[model samples]
Target: MLLPKQMTRVLIVGSRNALKDTIEVLYQLEAAHLIDFSAEEEGFSLGAPLPESSVASQRLLKLRSLEKDMGIDDEDVSGQMETGQIEMDLASTIDGLEAEITGAIESKNKINLRINELEADKAVLQSFQALPLDLELYHDYDSLKVFTGKVRGDPSALVKAAAPQSEVFLSGNGDFAAVFVNTAQADEAQKALVQVGYTEVPAPAGPGSPQKHVAKIDEELEALRSSMKEAVDKLDELKDKHSTFVKAADEHLSIIVEKAETPLRIGTTEYTFAMDAWVPTSEMPKVEKAIAEKLGNRAHLESLEVMSRMEPHGHDEEGEEHAPAKVEEIPVKLENGKTAKKFEFMSGMLSTPKYREIDPTSAMMITLPIFFGLMVGDIGYGIPFMLLGLIGLKKCVSDEWKTISTLLFFGGIWATVFGVFLFGEAYGIHFAEQAHDLSWSSLLGVQLPHELVLGGFEIPLGIYSKLHSVKQILYMSVWIGIAHLFIGFCIGFYNKSIRYGMKHAIIEKISWLMILVGGALLLLFVVDFMILGKDVALTDIRMLVAAVLLVIGIGMAYKGEGSGAILELPGLMGNIISYTRLAAIGMSKAGLALAFNTIAFEVMWGHDFHVLGSNSGDIVMLIAALGIFLVGHLTIFILAIISAGLHSLRLHYVEFFMKFYEGGGVEFKPLKVIRKYTIEKNGVSE
Candidate 1:
């Protein structure tokens, strides 16, 4: 459960004629992680793709183009399609869809282009309407040069000065001007118009009033818009008709293309091919039996080596060595229970664990939520968190949201437990009466029991308050840190022992274990001597043992890890101190909750409102106090999710995992097809 599934390297060799059959068998088994052929092997070359690849690739390209034109999203695929049905209809359906969709798209594009042109013409005609001129009257003059456009101010005076023979018609708005001059003085007249910030609006080529032309354009625009709507509806109808087929066909063709390309990863001669792959050791027997039964004497499976957690090592030699020239990495496939699998994403966010190391997902699953619950220990928030997480788990399909839901569900369980037993609080208020502070019992004017008895056994509801129990909580957090790191070091020791041998593991990991133990002892001594003011001296048994351990551990660490160990002495203490944040965050939340509770209770009590049936306080003041309480607690609830969630994750990643984890391994991915929109009633192609 703590390690990745063991892998065995296998070599499958076969006649070139059986290549396709071999590929199909391996994909069906879904156990092979194929290694790409290097092409350096003597007298061999990479295999060629099968003949069907070209035809399938062409069909897939056309199907994808149709999908794009139809604006098909994954959600648009409504139902599954049988592979046999898809195969029978794919060719004819693709041809029909291409032709029909092409026509509709072209028609729609033409209509849109026409509508844009008509809108532009209408704008120009409207501008000319302001000038009080007919479309033809502004143009088609032999001796006159007409300037018809808008101007910042009136250009009538300036135009008249430039050419006395020119006629300047200024609209009532004085912004639109139409100047007509003889061809000889056109240049001078234009210069005068430019002086007043003139911009020209070309007259449309037509023979009618400006308003009449604009009305005509509007009618044409309405017709084109109707046509566009028809075209869009036609495409939508076709998309609805053929969406399932297109999606299924795409999947089918993609699978074919992938299988065809598998040969490119293997070595081939004129008559024979060789493939290299890794399969889980436990599945080797099944794979071998399948190949022998399916392909007979044409293909042979040979087991090369069963990989071990202990790495292979050898001394340098002049003669031929036992190790291969190249050392291929054995891919890691983590083995975890369903519960632990949810936290795999968190570990993967760091990196996949190497095959030689223990998988950390199980460990993280056990601790991460406990840390979160410790930080956000409140029943008020915990119940709501559990509900939201349960809903998310049922609704969410993505890995990210599922992982978050898992954290919330598990963390909320622990939070509720701690809130009931350890803190005995709900939304920052104690259940029992407080000496000087407000509590549920005090506010309600009822006596709330401090403990509950079941079957003659007493269980204290509230053991300690978050704010008042800071010293103990902080002390407990430190020990939690110690125990967590101790687990990490033990795993590291085992990992190193397997990977490099017991001597190296003892020198590297056991040395740090000593230092951690020594520091824990010294912590106790310091608390007794300094905080409690005890008369303990330097000769105390705990102090002497701690000192000896520190000296020996430091010496061993220096010998194993060199000078870096000496420098890390203070850093170890800092790592332990970092766990105090667990206490600090809870206290901060409690402080906020306390302030809100105080304000709300003060408001209600000041107005003389004690219980629900009280006639002393006004209903308006009660409502106001309730509003403040709700909003304040809501804010704290949201902050709890972010602060508690993130700090808990950080504790695992930065402090705990740093002690043991060195992850960066390739994840095991086998060659197989995932059919979402399609199902095969008949078996896959041979």
Candidate 2:
């Protein structure tokens, strides 16, 4: 389809008591894209969550916390248990599981805390152990001043000279020192200690010898570590036992909570609730039938309006007049077949197509990969790309990977086709033979034909070489760009005509179309007269027509868009020139291939200046040539994906799409459930 699917506004009203049943039917139908409730509705309020939600929610929260504490993951679990089994076990098991998990975690925390304390105490004791003193002697000294810390050098002689009545102790390592001096001479002792570059560490308060204290703390740490290990093992056991059940029960309870809370988005009164939504026009009949059969008199559905592509009309009226209709943002639901759906995300990256306009995914899918192929143009790389894409499609699940795979698969097909017919090349070499260059015919030691005679006509395999046909390829790309933009402007004209009016559409888009056509004609004339070196007169028919068209087109554009149109004239010229990159990239890759081939075969072999020249006869030289050939080609292959892939995408996003696309419409998001770990069983479809 050219545009998104049409939508119809629906109002579903039901008694407050029947809200639950009505919600169940809607989920089962899976058609509505519900609008949120607003306070503007008189006598209506937002509905509260059901009573069952509270208990289930609380239990689910605790279960998640337990899952985290035990390091339980969905991947770690292996089997699915029955829903009945889960429901039966959840109530009784949750409370006991919570108690067990909480106790295990608390014990682990306590052990960790004690281990940290013991480790700190052991560190302090180790420093004191060097002094050969009891911990009590370092702290309990009223008539003495004790200086205990690590020192740069032993200061026994210095301390003795400063305080005559001082006692000094030195560690066997001589890094720890303790000086005790009479209270009257403490100031002198401190000054003497400062000369030895001492930094004080306060003596730890304890009653035992330092060596015994260290031993005691080490014993306690070992016991705490053992307890910590036991706690970890217990947590692991619980995870192994319950990860599957926990994930499944979480899915089950989550579905219940979500359905119960549906009324939160619907307006509610004391007696009834109102639900506003959009459903595809085609599905409206099915929805209506389901509601009538399931809900009966408990609910009422009113089809308010069937939306159209044309914008709504409103204007000022007399005395008893109505307010102008506001332009509602219709959500876009693209209609695409399986093949086209793969390209949807690429277009969606810019924004969803507006409901009233064309869905551009089809156009993008056709052109994007072709541009990629044109830039690459080689069967050697194309086959690998196709293989990569096929593998990715099979193994990868994400939308991004799948889209990339789609590009590679489609692009590879076009690349191979162009390589065989248009360029007759693989890995930048012509399939047959070319003057002063290598070819597969020479490499394989066989003759290859340049053309095949079919039904009395000669068909050339190689039409135009990428590096040798720069001007022709560049000219063709420019014309291709012009044709693509012409299509863009036409689509834009149609969109604008429906959205506003024909007059506005013609002035905005048709005017630009006229300018583009005139410029294209002028380019043809210029190429013929200048590049072809053909004589041409100023009064030539093509020149006269181009001048007139350009003047009229610019006049119309300036009238519609003011002076901004004039400023954009140069930009239009630049957009056309941008297409030259298609040929430029191909030429660059060909040049690289030629250089690698020369280095590996011609220069190294030094026998003939040809790409297919035999490698050096020496065994070591042959191996070196083969290594260079592999590594050099490998670099080009990897680079081809990046440069070719990104540049082709850029041409679409920046140049082609800018011609008409003004995306940013809201995407249609229907109320639905996506199941992962749990599946409905026993013929239940919910």
- State every prediction's TM-score relative to the real structure: 0.95, 0.92
- Please give the RMSD of candidate 1 to the true structure: 3.3
- Report how far off residue 79 is in candidate 1 (Å): 0.8
lDDT values of the candidates? Answer: 0.88, 0.84
Per candidate, the number of residue pairs that clash is 0, 0
Mark the 10 consecutive residues where model 2 has the least summed lDDT: 314-323
Q: Per-residue lDDT of 1-686 in model 1, one digit per residue for the tens?
A: 79899999999999999999999999999999999999899999999998889899999999999999999999889988888788888788889889999999999999999899889888887777887667788777899898888899999899889988899888788888889999899999999999999999766787879888888888999889998999999999999888988999999999989999899999999999999999999999999999999999999999999998886862122211257567778899999998999899999999999999999999999999899888889888888888878998899999999999999999998889888888988999988987756678976789888999988989999888999989999999999999998898899999888877787788888999999999999999999999889899889999999999989999888888878888988988888999999999999999999889778866766634334344445688778889999999999988988999999999888888888888998899988889999997663443
Total residue pair clashes for candidate 2: 0
Candidate 2 per-residue lDDT, tens place, 1-686, comes to 87899999999998988899888888888888888887787899999987788888998898888888888876887766556667778899989888998998999898998888889878877888988779899776789989888888989999999999999999898988988899999999999999999989889888888888888888888888888999999988888887888888888788878988888999999999999998889899999999999999999989999998766651111111144465457778899988899999999988888887888889888998888888888887788888888898888899999998998888888778777777888877888977867787777678777887899998777788988888898898898788877888888888777766687778888999999999998998999899998899888888888998899999998888778889989998998898888888888988998788778775356756463444445677778878888888888878877888888888888887887777888888787776666665543232
Error of 2 at 93 (Å): 2.0
| CA RMSD, predictions in order | 3.3, 3.7
Name the regions of candidate 2 deviating beyond 4 angstroms: 81-84, 191-197, 205-209, 313-327, 452-459, 501-503, 611-617, 681-686
